[model samples]
Target: MISKAEAKHIWVLAEQKKGKVANVALEAIGLARKLASASSQEVWAVLLGQDVGGLAEGLIQSGADVVLVVEHPKLDTFRDDPYVDVLAHLAENHKPAVFLIGANSAGRSLAPRLATKLRAGLAADCVELSWDAGNLVAVRPMYGGNVLATVTCPEARPQMATLRPKASPRPVLDASRKGRVEKVDLGGLQIRDRVKLLESVETGGGEVKLEEADIIVSGGRGMGGPERFAVVKALADAFKGAMGASRAAVDAGWVPYAHQVGQTGKTVSPKVYIACGISGAIQHLAGMRSSEIIVAINKNPDAPIFKVATFGIAGDLFEVVPLLTEAVKKEMS
Candidate 1:
């Protein structure tokens, strides 16, 4: 077991895709900056990919005091075992005080594995974090998001946690902020790649990411049918935004699960979230309550969605949506 004195830095997983850094990784760095400042520890980002050493300087600027790059041909895609093994080796060698992984596709699968390998305490999907006399404390949603639980790892040397994307504030790009670029080696450890990604297919008509969208227009059961969802699509198109759906809309076969947003689905914190005909169930609100601005359009004046919405439109979506879409198009044009 490593002592607190042996653990010296805060490590942030720099998850990347298609040779570019994912937004969640930058968000992790932003969070690590704050946590490192509180604990008087240096912030380091673990960058692992082929030809990703070019991203180290950018990570340093993003908030990392040092960027640890593990470049190899076998580490191109999001293969689970190689990634976990490499990180485990790193943790065992250079013990960190805090280890943070973004709660995204790659991270969700990787966090627990790494934690178990290192025998470290892990907090999953934490939305908020604070320091209690230099110890890290994590706060996350509980009981279908009806409650928030604050957790601390008192027995672990290197505390581990996975943070949902957009749970922390994005840091401003500062080119002047620079640090060290470190290339880490595997020490002759043979990495056996079992999973081979043969091909990849892209779905969704509009090429927009729901999680990173600045504007999102979502439809619920009020859309009636997939055909009626055209108005919602039109609105999203007019704004050049992404399309989202409540669980009801997705379960009804109106849209795919990729568009679903809720407690059971994806948690999104877009800049502007427009809910069309959504009843605003507790589960749904739990996913998007963090949006910068929320607009609710529902026929029922007493709909719960209106309570959390920044703007309320008490009208039938069939009549209101088309007109609204046209107005948005006109305003933008």
Candidate 2:
């Protein structure tokens, strides 16, 4: 229970990829809104990139009360040094009550550094965040999903937590909400790391990132062989969704690491997730159990995937997938 006098504005470190707002940024803003409401404070978004102000309106629509835009030519590409300097500067100047960041590659890389710079306790990969009586509580899984730990940052002035991208609900657009924009000047930050983005290879036309896809078709060991992944891809294509794979399949070289979903991979909360031949280990379930609707197809009726599945089909995936794909294609046509 944060007192009215003590609580300051909530801040979200918004990330931009290829000149577009990352989905995780919106997710963080959504969670920020809930925290801000509880504390009676404004929700501020810190966006860093070249021409980032163009994205401020979208952030406002997604529930940000105010967006602090830090636009610099050196910040155009995501390099570690410049981003860390800017975020550290913001943390020192604005003095937010709580700072939320997405637990993605960039956030994971920067949050710990920023926390160290501020001398604050940092919680990473937190699945849930809330204010308890006045203290910020960050909850995360521990002991390989065996236990959950809730941490309270009491002494830290600005508590920091990074949330998994798909762990929260999407924010509803609020056109009436308004706030001011503060342009921060990155005074003397030099780009020390010379990682240049020469080219980007967009897989599968880059239609939808698996984390943000409304529908996902995932394969597992029962997918048989790497050659058979086309069947899963066909189904994903039929639904206009992205293709994902379980850790087992990915380790077996059946799919790329980018498409793997599990404890060691991406966490996703799609509207619909279809698991084909997946055994659904606890580690795998931790990644996508938050999906709105889970459809599991496995030859073994007792597969653990069926435990949390909204719908389960016990059958050979080789026999069921093609027929299901055809049915979906027919419906779409």
Candidate 3:
């Protein structure tokens, strides 16, 4: 256990893949900047990957005071052991006061491992974060989106938490910012090569990554069938947004599983989420209730989705979607 006096800088695990930095890192950095300011501390980013040095500039501009680079050819593709080994070593030495991670697939796996190794308290999938009484408070949905729970790691020296992607506003880019980038050597580190990644196929084809989209047009069981998703696609295309589907839609084979958004699928915090013909089940709201704006279009006026929506259109989506799509295109023209 580390003492409060011994704990220093706020460290954000700058998760990246194949050299491109994950967008969530920027949001985490933005939050770290706020948390660090309260304590008059520094925000340090720990980037782990091969050939990731080029990304240091972007991280620095995004609000990190220092970027710690861990480069290794073995890290080109994410391997559990090597990554855990390197980060565990850093935490052992630096003892950061707060550690933030993106709550993505890789981060979900890494945070728990590091938290266990460091014996730190961890709050996962936090939608909000702030300092209260000198403790970092993490707020996340609980009871299947029925309520929010605020968690705190008061006794832990290095408080650990994972922020859902886009939980915080994106940090403004300041190219004028200057920061230090230090390359750390991972020598004498014994890594257990138990898992091997033989083949990695990219999903989404040419479609936009659902989680990264600023706007999403999604459909549900009310959309009728797979062929009817064309209207949903048109609305999505009209907005230059991504296409999404509720679990019922995916389970019904109306769309691929990749487009699913719900408790069992991807969590999206887009600028705008248009729910077309979705009944707004609690499971689905848990994934996207954090969106900046929600427009619910459902035939049922009492659909639960309208509860969290910024705008509600209680009308037949069959008639609404095409007219809405035409209006958007006409305005753009």
Candidate 4:
């Protein structure tokens, strides 16, 4: 076992795609900054991509004390084997005290493999993170978001955890903040390029990320059919927010699975979450109950959703949603 003295800085894997950094990556940096301040440690942001050296400055402004940029042709796009091999190499060399990764699609796939490579303990999908006397305490939701269980890696050298998207505050950008940027070359590094990317498709039509949206309008089985999603989209567009759907809607083929919001889908903590025709099952609530304000519109007043909604309207969403949309448009105009 590696001693505590061997581990030094806190590392955040800055996830980027097509030259744009993800919000969750910045959020992880922000959380890392908080932890670093408490422990008197430096925060390192590791960026891996081809020709992504230019994006290093933005990461410094977001509060990284050091930025490690690893460029490679194979890393131009995300593939599991290559990413895992590179990250594991870095972690083995650096031996950071804590390693934080965003609990997104790519992160979920990458974290476990990297952790296994380093023989480190992993806490997945943690809603909160803190330092507990040289140990990293991760608070993760359990029993379908009804319980929060705290986990710690007391014996592990690098305490690794995956932070859930939108669960923490975004770092404020400050251009004046300066930091060190180092280029890590892929010298003699034989990466395992098992997965080949023949083509890339944009199935969601480049829609706004549900986790980053300030407001979200979601529908459930109560939306009736696929056609009724138009009402949900209208409200979402009116607010310039993203549209979401419950698992029932997605399972019924009323909408794409990308719009699903629930335990089995995506977790969202928007400023406002409007549920139309949703019955509010526990599974669905587990994903979005963290929204600042919840508005539920359903004919059933006794729906489990009303129990958590800030405001509840018991009526037909067809008639009510159209009126609500018109009212919002009128008010905005």
Candidate with best lDDT = 4
In model 2, which runs have C-alpha deviations exceeding 4 angstroms?
Answer: 1-7, 189-200, 330-333
- Model 1, position 224, has a per-residue lDDT of 90
Regarding lDDT, does 1 or 4 come out ahead?
4
The lDDT values for all models are: 0.88, 0.85, 0.89, 0.92
- Summarize candidate 1's per-residue lDDT along 144-228 as a digit string, tens digits: 6778899998867688889887788777778999799889877798776787889977788546889878889999988899888
The candidate with the higher lDDT, 1 or 2, is 1
Per-residue CA lDDT of model 2 for 1-333, tens digit only, reads: 222345488899879987787788798899989888997888999989987788888888888888999988878867777787788777777778888988888888888988887777788888889977766899987755567899878877578898977778778888887877888876775545556668867776656788778899999999999999999999999999999999999999989899998899887878899999899999899788878999999999999999999999999999999999999999999
Per-residue C-alpha lDDT of model 4 across residues 144-242, encoded as one tens digit per residue: 789999999988868999999888989999999999999997689879999899997877676678888989999999988999799999999888789
Candidate 3 stretches greater than 4 Å from native: none
Which candidate model has the greater TM-score, 1 or 2?
Answer: 1
When sorted by TM-score, best at the front, the candidate numbers are 4, 3, 1, 2
- Ten-residue segment with the worst summed lDDT in candidate 3? 185-194
Query: What is the Cα-based lDDT of residue 206 in candidate 2?
Result: 58
For model 3, residues 1-333, the per-residue Cα lDDT tens digits are: 677778888899898887777888789999999988887889999998888899999999999999999988767777777777788888877888899998888888988988887888999989899986678899987766678999999787689999988788889999999999999987788766678889988886767788888899999999999999999999999988899999999999889999999999888989999999899988998778888999999999999999999999999999999999999999978
> Which TM-score value belongs to model 1?
0.94
Model 4 lDDT, full chain set:
0.92
The C-alpha TM-scores of every prediction are 0.94, 0.89, 0.94, 0.96
Residue ranges of candidate 4 with Cα displaced over 4 Å: 330-333
- Model 3 earns a TM-score of 0.94
